[model samples]
Target: MNRPQDHLAEQDNVRRVDDVTSALEGLVTVLGQEEDLSVVLRRACLQAVQAVPDADLASITLVRDGGHYTATSTGDAANRIDQAQYDAGQGPCLEAARTGTVQRVEVSEVARRWPEFTAAAGAAAVVSYLSAPLFIDTEYQGSLNLYGAGGDGFGALDAALLELYTTAAEAALRGARRYVSARETVGRLRTALTSRAVIDQAKGMLMAMHRVSADQAFDLLVKRSQEQNVKLREVAEWFVADVLNA
Candidate 1:
């Protein structure tokens, strides 16, 4: 069964498909300017926040095991305390992650439902909460939350917008994630290739030092790598550096 206002969420989700084309254009242009992940997530979160009018304090959370970890925040006290709720394992963030749906809590009623979360939030001056789930296909992976100071933090329309923004974030995150992973992998491979050369030079040194054959020296290197539980390239780097620097 759908929520009371599911239709509105559906509309927002459809509208998001259109809105993100512009958002993605901005993202691609920005990517040329800077390639940092924080820069990327920050820009994406800000876009999502602005796309949704009711967001006062916007945040993104990554879901793991029906729990949430703060991905980014709008630099607000309420959103900060929301991080505490995730740490405490009790809050609207968890609820949204668990159900893969929107969750809203007014400040006045929060004390009764989430006593601990509310108390901690009171110290931070947080009074209202709304979160929309972010999904990749049928799998719910994360959420976007918006905090109001208190009272009617989000209306039906606000929830709809929240869902839209969450979807947009999901799309942008997927794109960035792929690019970052590929880039990192290429970097590691390049480094490893360099290390391989250094190791081969070190192996030659070992062969001369022990009066051993090349195959025997290589066996020694592999055995040492297993014993130390470090990468072969690390051992090679150290060996070459010692010889060169000595």
Candidate 2:
């Protein structure tokens, strides 16, 4: 026969699983509504605190150009804790990002491993720490971190839940990043097209006014651009504006 405590534990596990599922669904909804990666990450951090057991604070540690920084955090304490790691050049968050694994430990246990980080975290009243690697791509490597004040620290179940959450969060972030990149590429193409049209107009005006060939007209615009220390597009735009206003 099953014990009463075992039954209660099973119930708790079911509730925790439900909470994680709801959090993941909420994240997907937020991702669709928000295009900014920072906003999405902020929401994710807040949700992580709610979804992960024993989590008091959360933050995302991002590594770029061989340097790391806290991209988004739940509160000042989390930021301070993350800064301690950055200053020390070693911490659970950094280790998770570097090793592409989950890191969970009690502050007291890891004192010797990360003295400065543990000191700062202990000062902040954060006892437990959990971090899961977030692999978006080569350009964007990071980890989602959770800080807990509870004495028992995070359990195996907590780490499993966090891994699931980070997996969903990573997919959302990758999609958002791709969307942003595509939007930027489209904006650049549009600007290029507009500049080309303006330059073509300027070339047409020069061809008509100076009776010069298309190549000669383009050469003239280049010469003016060099002389004025301005971009060819700017010179073309100015010449076209001058002729139009005349």
Candidate 3:
């Protein structure tokens, strides 16, 4: 025996879930097109603010070698609060990142736990806070935080929504980092190959002009490079340039 109200409530819940799924799908598409890690991180924070209904502000905090900093934040308010925690060496965001756990702080009890963070957040009218730890094995560790301005702050549904957002964010960020690294490696390899090709061309030209062996021509290039105190690649390039102009 299902009541009409219960049926309507179930329908609304389904609609909310659908909306969240669609939003995340859109986020995946957007992130796929981005190659910069910093842009990806900032987009993740902004998306968190939009995806979670109760989230008024969002930010990310990263920890490395016992040092921590706010990677990106939605606004000055969020950064100010995060910096207070980093300065005082205590806050929900820091604790969540260090312990790899979720931290929830209510305005009423925040003062008792982290007095310094509370003072800063209170001035900005932040009434509630939630931090979800993002961990990818032992390599990457950080926390995604959401701030609420007033009312009851965040309920179970809000926390659950934030968890889902963080899950997607972590995946997108890791993929972006890998893509950037691979692109940089490819760029370096290409430059090395180009340099080698130019140097070989210069060596062949020297051997043909001087009627010398490959070893003797290479030794001559090295001698010129040493005499000019320049890179072997530069000496080779100069010789090739001169040949081209001649």
What does candidate 1 score on TM? 0.66
Give the per-residue Cα lDDT of candidate 1 at 51.
65
Ordered by lDDT, highest first, the candidates read 2, 3, 1
User: What is the Å distance of residue 11 in model 2 from its true position?
Assistant: 1.9
| Candidate 1, superposed: residue stretches over 4 Å from native | 1-28, 63-69, 108-112, 123-128, 135-141, 150-152, 201-213, 219-246
**Model 1 residue 101 distance off true place after TM-score fit, in angstroms:** 1.2
**TM-score for each of the candidates:** 0.66, 0.94, 0.87
Which is the leading candidate under TM-score? 2
Cα lDDT for residue 45, model 1? 66
- Please write out the lDDT profile of model 2 over residues 9-109, one tens digit for every residue: 99999999898888888888998899987898889888887788679889999999888999999889899999988887889999999999999988766
Ordered list by TM-score, greatest first: 2, 3, 1
- How displaced is residue 86 in candidate 1, in Å? 3.6
lDDT tens readout by residue for model 1, 1-246: 888689887887667555645665676666667667667766766666566555667776777665567777888664567677876667777678768889877777667777777666557665677877765434336666777765556776667666755665677666666777799999999987788788789799999889998888888888888999998878877777888899
Q: lDDT of each model, Cα atoms only? A: 0.71, 0.89, 0.82
Tens-digit lDDT string for candidate 3 (1-246): 999999998896676666567767766877789776667778778877777767888888887778888888999988888887888888888888878777887877778998877765557778888999976435557788888997788877777777877887677667777777789999999999988998899999999999999999899999999999999999999999999999
